[model samples]
Target: MSGSTFALRVAQGVGFTGAAWLSGNIAALSANSVPAIISSVREDNISPNVACKQWRNMYEAGKTQNPPIAFATASSFAYVAWSVRQIPRSLAASAAYGGFGMYVAAAVLTLSIVPYTVAAMRPTNNALLELAESKGDRVTSSAEVEGLLGRWTTLNWARSLLPLAGGFAGIAAALL
Candidate 1:
């Protein structure tokens, strides 16, 4: 009935979709890319160069979906930003305000990771991207690629937690 109620619903929807996209990205990395990299490194059946190429190929393919996913994630934040202002300052008796608070927390929590990711992970990501796009010899050796990917995957896990939490929080907010 209220604007906050509507906003919470929007946040819930957007957050869930965004979270699902993010999870898929993680799942692909976990299920496919990471294992492939490990297999490439340890086993003689797959050469390091071949594996690196596969990894780079897959990495580039995966990146194509990022823009839409990023937009979806930002949409959730937008809903929260719009809705929170509708909530009153006096939170003593308002359930709607409480719910909005959770929604805001969801956005804030998720957004908090962005800066760290941009600042910390950007260079490594750029390097990998360049490798992915490169047609000739890789800039780094296979061992280094493996290390970089391992670090990226580890950081990705950390990055994933926030939107997941935000999605759940948004759901709770909507229900409340």
Candidate 2:
């Protein structure tokens, strides 16, 4: 209900959506490789026409033969690429909706952190004020403020990490 609390909620919502979009972009780039991989996978004699007709002709002539070799000649990378390609279009489609969901979730998450941040800041601010009022005199109370700030910093960092990790996981899951 406080101004800071409201601001935190808004920030969280924005951060979450930003994270999701970032993830989606990564997934999109990865997914784009799928079509190429599919083409490459089919490049073998098994499906000469899976890719370009020019390559098919070369295959028929025995001039060159190998899977179109997407990602790399390495099967594992190829498989990873293929896996990336396999991410359902529906998921991507749903990502559009998921974006909104992320925003809401982020907002809620951020809002939840407000009270904790406020609590942390209160002691820190008090110490800071006390130190300032002392006018150059050393103040032991500054340590409490510093500690609270450190805790807040750690939590903020954690908040950032969650969306990043979640986004990557979502992308990986989609790829699989």
Candidate 3:
């Protein structure tokens, strides 16, 4: 009814939608794409260079697409927190506080994947990128590509969890 109420609803909707989309997108890469790339090497007898190139393409796509989703989701969650904080505490003090806290948590969790990618995933990413670009010059063996893909898959799954949790947090905020 009120403008702030409408804003909170909109923010919550955006936050939840974005989080779900982002998390699922990243997880799909980990679960499906990366594994298929790995299989292309191990089972399909594809060249390591080819597999590396495929991975690089996937990486580039995710790099271009995922960050914007993360930024939007985190921003929406933060906006939700801010909007909830503006509500008069006298009207519903406990719910307002709880919602604010949950929304803040959601924002933090959604944003954390950036640092996680930087700290945990970057080394493997760089190595794989170099191997992809090197076109067999840098690669020591197929095992190297396999190892890198496995590591990336694990790290990406971990990365997906943050947004998943953030989405759940946003849902909890809505219930509050």
Best by TM-score: 3
Model 2, residue pairs in steric clash: none
RMSD values for the candidates in order, in angstroms, are 3.8, 27.1, 1.3
Model 1: worst 10 consecutive residues (lDDT sum): 44-53
The clash tally of candidate 1 reads: 0
In angstroms, how far off is 18's CA in candidate 1? Answer: 2.7
lDDT of 3 by residue, 49-141 (tens): 889889999999999998888999999999989988887778679998999999999999998988999999999999888888884456457
lDDT of 2 by residue, 1-176 (tens): 97644544444334434445533432332244323433354454322222223322322332122112111112222232333343456746665345444433333332332343356435543443444344334533323433433443444444334345543433443333
TM-score, predicted candidate 3 vs. hidden true structure: 0.94
Residue 18, candidate 3: alpha-carbon lDDT: 95
User: How does candidate 1 score on lDDT?
Assistant: 0.67
Looking at candidate 2, what is the lDDT of residue 1? 100
Q: Write model 1 residue lDDT over 1-176, tens digit each, in one string.
A: 88767766666677777865675675567566777677767775555555556766766665576545755675786677566657666644366776767777766655555665688768777766666666666445767777777777777677667667766776676666
lDDT of 3: 0.91
Lowest-lDDT window of 10 residues in candidate 3?
A: 133-142
